[model samples]
Target: MSLKELLKKKETAIVAQWFDRVVNTYQLDTSRFLKSQKDAFANPVGNTLLQGLKAVFDETTDRMDNETVISFLDPIIRIRALQDFSASKAVGFVFFLKEIIREQTAKETQGNAALQAEMLLFESKIDELALTAFDIYMQCREKVYEIKANEVRNRTFTAFHRAGLVADWEEEPRH
Candidate 1:
């Protein structure tokens, strides 16, 4: 069977392993909570992550275009961007899929040139996905910073107005 066929056959196991790896990036208590809590509302981060991972895995295996793959990646990256993670940490989950796939399919690809080539292509796709994820993370971080700057500007303006140091300009009447 081809690499794609093998991946599809092992999708459940691969995704489960991938999810575990991603969740383990968090604190021990938080990882346990994320793994155990199945409610979407109560565990929104976990829910988003699982859903995102499944979608991204499906897209990657199917050789979907970058834009399509990025749609699945956005939510996961956005959530990570808001957290206390550096840029690499925010986008590092994409690489976890590569390791999970390799571990899951190593035996089959071993000594099989065709399967090994396919695996290389699949890994390249994963690299592209990681690059896209990093871009998304940066965009999310930029938006967060913009919102914070706006808040600070608004607060400063309010304080100045309250202190009579700044005033709203009155429109002059036109003749």
Candidate 2:
């Protein structure tokens, strides 16, 4: 069978495995709760991950649009960023996909040139996704920093201004 056909056939299993791996990166309680609840509202992390994987797989196998892949990955990466995950941990899910694809297609692509080429193509696409994910991850971290900086500034603004630590715009009247 063709690589795309194989991926299509095993899509559900791949997604489930991917989701399991991603959830495993979280804390024990968070992982258990996320895995136990299937409702999108109650378990948004798991839900977003599954949806992102499905969309990424579908798009990659069909056309491999970089922007669309990044868009699909945004929710997953943003949540991870908010969860206090490091940059590598936040974006490493894309690399996990390579392992999943390799496991599923290794046997079929071993001796077939066409299948081997398709596998290479697919792996390259995963690399593209990884790069895109890194960009998304950085953007998410930047936003987190921006929010934190704003909070600090807001909390200190009045104190600093009252002490004349900050420059005033208006001229002071002569005593």
The sequence of per-residue lDDT tens digits that candidate 2 reaches over residues 1-175 is 8888989998888888888888888889988998888899988988898888889888888888777888889999989888767788889988888898888777887889998898888889888888888888889889989999999998899789888888766655557
Which residue pairs clash within candidate 2? none
Model 2 residue 110 CA deviation in Å: 1.9
Give me the candidate number with maximum TM-score: 1
Candidate 1 regions exceeding 4 Å error are: 156-175
The best candidate in terms of lDDT: 1
Candidate 2, which segments miss by more than 4 Å at Cα?
Answer: 155-175
TM-score of each: 0.87, 0.84
| Model 2 error, position 115 (Å) | 0.7
Candidate 2 residue-pair clash tally = 0
Candidate 1 per-residue C-alpha lDDT over 1-175 given as tens digits, one digit per residue, 9 for 90 to 100? 9999999999999999999999999999999999999999999999999999999999999967788788889989989998878888889989988888889998999999999999999999998898899889889989999999999999998889899887456744557
